[model samples]
Target: MAPKQDKKVEEEEDAIYEVEEIVDHRRSKTKHNMVEYLIKWKDYAPEFNTWEKEHNVYSKGLINIYWAKQPYTLTQFKKKTHEGESSIPKKRPASSQATKIDRKQLAQEIKSSQISTSPPTGLVWTDIDAIVNVFHSEPNTYFAEVKWPGGKRNTYIPTRIIKKYNPLKLIYYYESQLEFYLPP
Candidate 1:
């Protein structure tokens, strides 16, 4: 009679462990430099989601399935805190020395390329004008130096949006976003 009761309790514990679905997942690093998945489980409240070690979750096929369902190829994974702020560290302004060097290098590269110095016009400006700089400010993140329809050059536009415009066939079949050229 005691053995039968213990078996029923074990069955109940097994039911609790079953995962119905995976809501979301983010990769995080532990103090020991080990990678883990911060998994948000379906049917469970957000507070109950757990960060399971990568090795443990990978063997169970949970992480792979989650990645397949929602593919995000970006390098960084942003996690939010309880206060609604992002956990990712803010990007520091590029140092003046580094900025100067980058500017010189970019100038030389652009000069050699066939890309026009004038702002793009009409349909091109609306569809494919490239993002020239990105700022840390809220509400507006990208600054595009566009050519107005009338051939006006260096007209800076503050936009909160930008998207990938070109892909390169270099070493890794790499994809590049619209060029971001910081003004001197």
Candidate 2:
């Protein structure tokens, strides 16, 4: 009887809990730039859900899934934190910051924009003024928001395509966002 009691205690000490789901995620309050996730245990009730830091959670898939559902991208979130600005700016930035391109020309081009019927020759790298934003749209697929020469509004172009034409722009954009993309 003593041996059986000791065995049970050992089993209890080594037990591992399965994760039911990742409920949510948030930046850690006590740690700088730390991410935490709300976890639901496989066999536990709602009240038993707990918050775990990014490193404590073993499954990277859960973190990716949680982020996929969010409207904005991780790079956008990081930009907001570092710049102390909203993810989407409400007003146009100061002329010193945004006046490199001609706004009136960009507005006219956008208003008169038409889809070409000719066979696609692919993107002309020179026409792209800047790579401004990035996001994950589908499994293994990523997109970059590009600022056209006239610069009234940005458009989405697949990052893979940009890599073929001008990889430097993508590299620079990623550096500015302070994000590193690694597959799990």
Candidate 3:
């Protein structure tokens, strides 16, 4: 029984946890030490402790990370964080900064904004802007955004409408759209 206890202790020793880290290359300059590093964050990575065991290179010096998520050059892994969710997540303001916001109202706003239309009676609008994706250049795959009466939106709309409407004409519209939005 004593021997079994000793073996159990040895097995527990093998289960040691090592924290993983990321050294961001974009924010890093070659140096002996003290590179730009990222602490393991929530929902952005596999369990850092487990990853450390699998990779065998658990040190911050070996791994690279970014303040913002991006494609990893070494492992070709995509590191993604949920900081910028489609709908803003409910965050409790620090108790130190004591202030009250109607949480139910905030949630209601989020629920409406995230959805295309409301549940009771929703007016379905085709994702017109999304369909007209404007790319860098005209290649095999092209893109553009078809402007509706409203602001910059990401929805698909039929191209024929662009030809008929004066404001909706797809001439050098990409260049001019900024004129309306930005000062010369």
Candidate 4:
């Protein structure tokens, strides 16, 4: 009974905003085949437009209409591959590999020392104070400069490593970059 009442309250609190239009669409970088729609709300200004996950926007009619007007199909969008040089400068492979091996060794040492850094079944516990920047080294490979808590100099860590740990930070950085580059 309490659960039902709680659900009802939750439904009541949820605001249903009318989607004015699907302004744009982009395939998600992290999730294959997943697309995000830029939603413009009826009563909101352009600044309020947001990129919503495929499942988050519920209006089937709007989604279908948006796709219908698109010149390319989702399949075509998925296959539009670009092999141009990365905007971000590349790092030396030798240095990058050395840094990665050191981190792995440190994690192993921590585990052997019984420092309770992480549970036995999980990945090693890494403390990332912040992600300073992201760089693309090659096609489908990115690196992030991460700051540590102990005042150590920032280290270049592969984005794949960071993605498994803190995906939101990467998302935020990319989103911010889009805002600057996207045409008004």
TM-score: which candidate is best?
A: 2
lDDT of 1 by residue, 74-104 (tens): 2323322322434553533446775555445
> What are the RMSDs of all candidates, in order?
19.1, 14.8, 21.4, 18.6
- Flag regions of model 2 displaced more than 4 Å: 1-10, 78-184
- The per-residue C-alpha lDDT of model 4 at residue 137 equals 46
Candidate 4 — which pairs collide?
none
RMSD (Cα, Å) of model 2: 14.8
Give the alpha carbon lDDT tens digit for every residue of 1-184 in model 3.
Answer: 8999999899767653333344233223443222344345334454442222223433322242222133223332223233344455444443433222332343344334432221112222232332223332213422233433345444322334433432234554444333222232
lDDT of 4 by residue, 80-139 (tens): 642243546243343556556544564444334432222123223255666655655456
Residue 143 alpha-carbon offset, candidate 3, angstroms: 5.8
Model 4: ten consecutive residues of lowest lDDT: 116-125
Deviation from native of the Cα of residue 62 in model 3, angstroms: 31
Off by over 4 Å in 3: 1-143, 149-152, 174-184
lDDT of each: 0.42, 0.64, 0.35, 0.62
If ranked by TM-score, best first, what sequence of candidates would result? 2, 4, 1, 3
